[model samples]
Target: MSLIAAASFFGWLVGPLAGGYLAQYGAAMAFQVAAVAVFLCMIFVATVIKETHKVSNEQSFLSLFKSNNSLTLLSHPNILNLFVLQFFSVLV
Candidate 1:
């Protein structure tokens, strides 16, 4: 978790600087670079990342979105705090 957080922090820190440099080439070029990066990330996840947990065949995908499970998660203090933080961050 610490490594993940550190990596995320560094990514956020560097993203703006990298984007500013890329933008000098042109807005379209910057967007194209971003799109290619996203495509490569998708490909990496699809091929390199392996699923460790066996998903139960019985559960429909929609079951994952059931309100009861969501409410249960929100009932936790830590989760609720995180939710609120994310909500306000998006507003900003």
Candidate 2:
């Protein structure tokens, strides 16, 4: 998890610097490069990834949304606090 976080932080820092270099070619070239990257990523995920989590027969995926389960989860104190903090941070 820490590795993922550190890599994500570095990617965010590096992406714009790399994009700026790509942008010198043309605005359209930058977008074209991004599109190809996304296409390669899609292919990689489709071929290499497998479902790891087991689903139970008793529970339907939509059960959370079918009842008030989602609303109840949102009303949890920790989640509610996180939402409030996020809202205020975004406002700033």
Among all candidates shown, the one with the greatest TM-score: 1
lDDT of 1 by residue, 1-92 (tens): 99999988987977777789998898888778878878998999999999999966676767766843667788889999999999999999
Question: How does residue 49 of candidate 1 score in lDDT?
Answer: 93
- Which portions of model 2 show Cα errors greater than 4 Å? 54-62, 66-71, 74-92
Clashes of each: 0, 0
Estimate every model's Cα lDDT from 0 to 1: 0.84, 0.82
lDDT assessment of candidate 2: 0.82
User: Which number leads on lDDT?
Assistant: 1
Off by over 4 Å in 1: 61-63, 73-92
How well does candidate 2 score on lDDT at residue 33? 84
Model 2 worst lDDT window (10 residues):
64-73
